[model samples]
Target: MMKHGLDPGDRRRPERLTRPELTARREAMERFLHVATPQLDQLYNLVCLSGCNVLLTDAEGVVLDQRMSEADAAQFRDWGLWQGADWSEAVQGTNGIGTCLVEGRQVTIHRDEHFHTRNIGMSCMDAPIWGPDGKLLAALDVSSARADQTERYNRLISAQVAQTARAIEAVFFRASFPEARIVVASDEGGDAAMLLAVDKDDLAIGATRAARRALGLEREGAIRPRPAADLLGRDDDMSGFDKAERAAVTRALARAGGNVSAAARALGIGRATMYRRMARLGLGEKQP
Candidate 1:
């Protein structure tokens, strides 16, 4: 709170968005809201069943969408935890949404952890949502007025919120790159949520957060539109040469509409060589 220039003991109510300001903010997030609403609704239903409220907020912590029963909404409105409220660290101090945005990670602000006295009654967990380009897009948060006042419970809720946020991010990433081929890569003996969007030439155009992490891509948007083989550690693999050969053949075939002769010409290989490589790679020519 001090870094954002707020005293921990500050007792003033946070600023609220005006009617026009709220509408404008919502409009700015229209694309994200549209892509995320279906999954958000599913998560909201599950959380509401447990008497919790789920909300979607932009990167700046402006609430875009919220889900809660009318009764619950009414009771929570007194704390300004509704739609159009600004929960940025600059405004709300160290609450879940605000802290998550600042840290760029999942967080749980339980009870007295909130810097504001008014927010002390609320316990909330939040996860950061990232776009296909690995940019922070928004935050997904679940809060409850009657939350379990236990550290273990807060940790459980934090994990749930993080998982929910990852699911939403995956859906958004796939939707954002509908025509790109999605490749799922996992660590040995472990399931991975990372999804790489590859082009016909097997060039990576985008990736999920998990994919970026697995590939050790530190710079944002740096791995995108690069050779997937290069970024995915194919150079050190035993079958790297064969895999590259197969990828080239597959790309040429796809680009030529599966016409063997055309694909061969595009790849600068004779028809016989194309046929031999295609047979080896298990690709069949399409009749044209």
Candidate 2:
């Protein structure tokens, strides 16, 4: 920060957005707040009595929402932990919120680890929240100015911050594709959520970053729509299962004299599902 002319000894607080500027900034976060605000409340209740403050920031690290104990309000404001404060690494230097956004990972800047000498008394743990497209969206931070807080305690709190961040990312991802079915790709991947959004036809419409990487697709944009089974290496048109299904459907239709509903009932499947299967198998159109 010295190269950028920021002095470690400087005690000035980060710049606060003007009233109108803050208002506009918040209005921009309406959708994000829809998914994050409630979770932040739950997290706040779990940690507020511990003398900590929870701050939610936009991708640029501008504080967008926060929850703090009223009793500790004065000191938190004095430290500039409030709505409109810009804590981007450009201004704050090596802090939890900014660094997490930059690194795309969870981070903890403990007391004395802060770049600004003035901020050295507070401990901050933050995790990056990812958007549906695998881009950095925002940060979730838990900061404590308590004198008795220790590194050991920060580790435990850090896990909560990370978990909540993932929860926000998952919810946002699902909301991004409401019409699709979200499938858990696997349970073994460590924090990075492995999920896939499959449409009604079983095509892969979207995937979480971890799943995209595992499936060898682009990480942050429109994935060329493909059969989920194809991507999973199960798209064998000539496989025994496909042949068997085609034969079964063909025989059911023949037995029912081309009546689709009767064929579906004989196959013990719903009419719509049976129609879909027949269409998928390229079977000739039959009467409903």
The root-mean-square deviation over C-alpha atoms between each candidate and the true structure, in angstroms, is 4.7, 5.8
Q: Given candidate 2, what's the lDDT at residue 228?
A: 73
Best by lDDT: 2
The residue pairs that clash in candidate 2, if any, are none
lDDT of 1 at 242: 81
Candidate 2 weakest lDDT stretch, 10 residues: 185-194
* Model 1 misplacement above 4 A: 5-12, 147-149, 188-193, 222-224, 235-245, 248-288
Model 1, span 1-288: residue lDDT tens: 677777777655556789899899889878778888887788777767556788899989988888888767765687778888889988888899999999998899888889988778888999999877788889999888775556777677778788878878887888878888887755462423588888776788888877888877654665637778677666644376788887788878899987888999998979988888777666764322
Q: Write down the lDDT of every candidate, Cα atoms only.
A: 0.80, 0.86
Give model 1's clash tally: 0
Question: What is the clash tally of candidate 2?
Answer: 0
The regions of model 2 sitting more than 4 angstroms off are: 187-192, 233-288
* Cα lDDT over the full model 1: 0.80
List TM-score per model, in order: 0.80, 0.83
Question: Mind giving the per-residue lDDT tens digits that candidate 2 earns over 53-161?
Answer: 9999999999999999889899889889989999998888888898888888889999888999889889999998877787778999999979899899999999999
Q: TM-score of predicted model 1? A: 0.80
